[model samples]
Target: MNYWLIKSEPSTYSWDDLVKLGSDHWDGVRNFKARNNIKAMKVGDLCLFYHSVNEKSIVGIAKVVKEYYKDPTTDDHRWYVMDVEPVRKLKRPITLAEVKAEPRLNDMQLVKYSRLSVQSVKEDEFGIILEMSEQ
Candidate 1:
């Protein structure tokens, strides 16, 4: 399964909110590239739930529970969304600052494309982040 990082501002929607809901539609992605990534998602894919802006960290893991479908809010239907369920909470959230300081994670998209809402996480990078969070 493909692995990705999905960003949401804590003030807008925190990790706690997702854990409370169990599963919910991930929508309101206005960027074309982010929307394309959402469209590419399939059931069972894993996502790193990252709190952007103030929190600036990877707080939890989530699994895509449903594949992409037309977003009801848009009449033209260019946008799509998927349902995701929280899988696990990190022992403690790993900060973006810590990620950037690690030389092993220098190549990660999380560092290179800081503003991208949805980005791929390389297998090695994913393992490294999980390892770091465990510390």
Candidate 2:
């Protein structure tokens, strides 16, 4: 299965907010690249739940429950969303600093495209992040 990273501002929608709802459609993606990433998602794909802005850390793991569909919150047909549910909160959040320090993650999109809200993660990068979280 493909691995991904989805970011949200805690003030807007925190990891706790998703956990409380059980599952929710990830919406409000305005960028074309981010939108495509959402569209590419499939049911069962895993995502890293990241707290962007101030936190700048991956706080939990999530799984895609449903594939892309018309965004209900918008009338624009170009926009889409996918349903995701919290898999589990990480024992420790992996901070941006930690990821930057790791040479293995140097080529990760999260490092190169820091502003991208939705990103594709290589399997090795995904595994490394999980390992860092375990520490």
Candidate 3:
């Protein structure tokens, strides 16, 4: 399955909020690139839940339960959203500094496009982050 990283500000919609809801529509993405990425998602894809702004870390995991659909928040026709099921929280969050310091993760979109809200993650990158969280 494809892997992705999605960001949300902890002060707004944090990982803890996701865990409480269990599953919810991933909406409010306004960036063109991010919007495209959300639309490209498929059911069963794994998502690394990243908290942006102050949190600045991967706090949890989620699984795409529903594919792309029209976003209710937007009046535009092309904008879309997805449904994601909360998977689990990482006991230790992998910070941005930790990620940037890892030589093996140099090619990650999270490293290359730091401002991106939605990004693709390679298998090795996913595995490395998972291993780091374990540590």
Candidate 4:
């Protein structure tokens, strides 16, 4: 079970939007690296839902419900998307400031590739973030 972090701007699509919809296709990823990350996802993989830009925090958990498929929003075949469902809202959001200050999360892709919309997370990093969110 690979762990991942996916970002969305709060104004465009927030964690609450996902929870209300129940589940939805994760689309609009234009970066080659991010698209590849989406393609790499498998059903049942867990993902952290992050609100980028202003909020800059991980607000909830989600699970992949479907594997990669053609991105319906785009005409290009190179892009792809996957379906994800909200697992639960975190007891407390893990902010970027908090993440940056934590030595355990120093090596996280979320910190290394700040602009990446979809990024992989190490198991230990995922565990640490989960533990932090509960506090």
- TM-score of predicted structure 2: 0.98
43-132: candidate 1 lDDT, tens digit per residue: 998999999998899999999999988877687678888899999999989999999999999989999999999888887888888898
lDDT of the structure predicted as candidate 1: 0.90
Q: What is the TM-score of each candidate against the true structure?
A: 0.95, 0.98, 0.97, 0.99
In model 2, the runs with Cα more than 4 Å from the true position are: none
Candidate 2 structure quality by residue, lDDT tens digits, 1-135: 999999999999999999999999999988899999999999999999999999999999999999999989999999999999999999999999999999999999999999999999999999999998888
Which residue pairs come into collision in candidate 2? none
Model 1 ranges with Cα > 4 A deviation:
none
Top lDDT model: 4
lDDT: the better of candidates 1 and 4: 4
Better of 3 and 4 by TM-score: 4
Q: Against the unseen true structure, what C-alpha lDDT does each candidate score?
A: 0.90, 0.96, 0.92, 0.96
**Clashing pairs for predicted structure model 4, backbone only:** none
Candidate 3 runs further than 4 Å off: none
Say which prediction, candidate 1 or candidate 2, comes out ahead on TM-score. Answer: 2
TM-score of 1: 0.95
Model 4 steric clash total: 0
Candidate 4 lDDT trough over 10 residues, lowest sum: 126-135
Q: Which residue pairs collide in model 1, if any?
A: none
